[model samples]
Target: MSIHVVLYEPEIPANTGNIARTCAGTHSHLHLIHPLGFSTDDRMLKRAGCDYWPNVQIEHHDRFSDIPEKYPNAVFYFIETIGEKNVYDFDYSNPDADYFFVFGKETTGLPSELTDQFKEQCFRIPQTDLVRSLNLSNTAAIVVYEALRQQAFAPIAIKEAAD
Candidate 1:
């Protein structure tokens, strides 16, 4: 199973860079929507991402509408704090469905109307009363790892015994 992460107007370059590294490590794809807070040419991101940026599969889109046309077969999932379904409750191991984990800007999330449009596709990470939410990159890591876990932590494998 492959994983795709969508960041809408990401605000921080460092965060985006770190997420890029994560995606590279996990063999996932990262998508950045237009009107980004920092230029994709920014040195900070490339520096933090450190030589792995090129290895990471990243795509840029002018708008949300542009994305759907390109990835018609992928399942788009909006991650928000108020989602009806917790991330844990969702089945992440469907080999047939390409999983897309979508996150909004750090300061303000996606327009409520947009989220409502895909209400059934929205999900949230469980949290305690003391915390409102997690950092965007951190949250992405959590969800991706969980999905990876469901896929049997694809990174690990048993070596065949030498005869």
Candidate 2:
């Protein structure tokens, strides 16, 4: 099973689109929890995803609670700026496991109720107090890539250049 990227109440179409492109490149599934800040047909979103939109596997959800019912066997990790553990602390190398990386909206972030419930699985990409947080798309990319890297970048063929 592949990794899944879940965006809860994402507010920026462009960020979502960029994350979609990253998900496409990594072969990760994307789940969007409504209400979204923009329409799926938004031009900016389309432009950001570009030709990779078709390659991205996307799903929509009405609420955060709907996800567990859908992917019953999947293990979820809530991503936030103030998580208790670092992203690298998790062992994502289990080939048989399916992981879901849940991110919040561009502005308010994941609801306290949700994050608190999943406190054990909460992870953060370490950053200094110099800034409030990184951009949404950038954070997604960083976390997804870290997970991919831990898994040896499986399902994403990597070839070395010819000597």
Q: Pick the candidate with the highest TM-score.
A: 2
TM-score of 1: 0.89
Q: Name the regions of candidate 2 deviating beyond 4 angstroms.
A: 42-49, 159-163
CA lDDT, candidate 2, residue 56: 89
Clashing pairs in 1: none
Tens digits of lDDT, candidate 2, 18-132: 8999998889999999999988875755566477887889999999889999888899999998698998999988888889999998899999998889999998989989999
**lDDT scores of the candidates, listed in order:** 0.85, 0.90
Candidate 1 residue runs with Cα over 4 Å from true position: 42-49, 155-163
Supply the TM-score for candidate 2.
0.93
Point out the worst 10-residue segment of candidate 1 by lDDT. 41-50
Q: After superposition, how far is residue 86 of candidate 1 from its true place, in Å?
A: 0.5
